[model samples]
Target: MNPINYLYLSALLFTIGGAGVLFRRNAIIVFMCVELMLNACNLAFVTFARLHGNLDGQIFAFFTMVVAAAEVVVGLAIIVTFFRSRHSASVDDASLMKL
Candidate 1:
């Protein structure tokens, strides 16, 4: 596929993910949306790496995936804790920071 097609697909996925993050009230759904956005970015990075015949983009994408994996672990832990404390996974239900 062409670079433009890759970019368009990435942009579309990113937009959908952003909308989900913004519109969803559940914390778990928001986290999943964030993951979607990260994967979309990874797709874009790999596409550019192939188009330019460079290893840097692939390396960056690898690093991003690692970070995203770490984020998923940490985010899920927090979500689990929040659900335990609040008994609900809705973002609006957890306002401990607002105090």
Candidate 2:
């Protein structure tokens, strides 16, 4: 596939993920959106790495995946704790935690 095609596909996936994050009310869905966005970024990174004939972008993508994994663990812990305390997984309900 062409690099441009890969770039366009990555952009589309990222856009959809962004919309999901902005409009979704469910915490799990929001998390999934975040994952989608992260993967899209990884795709772009790999595409650029291949296009440039360099390992740096691929290494960056690897680090991004590692960070994303850590984020998932921490994010899920927070979500689980919030659900346990509030009994609702709705994003709006989470605002109550500010107080």
The lDDT per prediction is 0.94, 0.95
Give candidate 1 regions above 4 Å deviation: none
What are the clash counts of all predictions, listed in order?
0, 0
Q: Give the per-residue lDDT of model 2 (tens digit) for 49-92.
A: 99999999999999999999999999999999989999988899
Best candidate, TM-score = 2
Clash pairs for candidate 1: none
Q: Per-residue alpha-carbon lDDT of model 1 for 1-99, expressed as tens digits? A: 556999899999999999999999999999999999999999999989988999899999999999999999999999999889889999998777896
Clashing pairs in 2: none
Error of 1 at 71 (Å): 0.4
Query: What TM-score does candidate 2 reach?
Result: 0.94
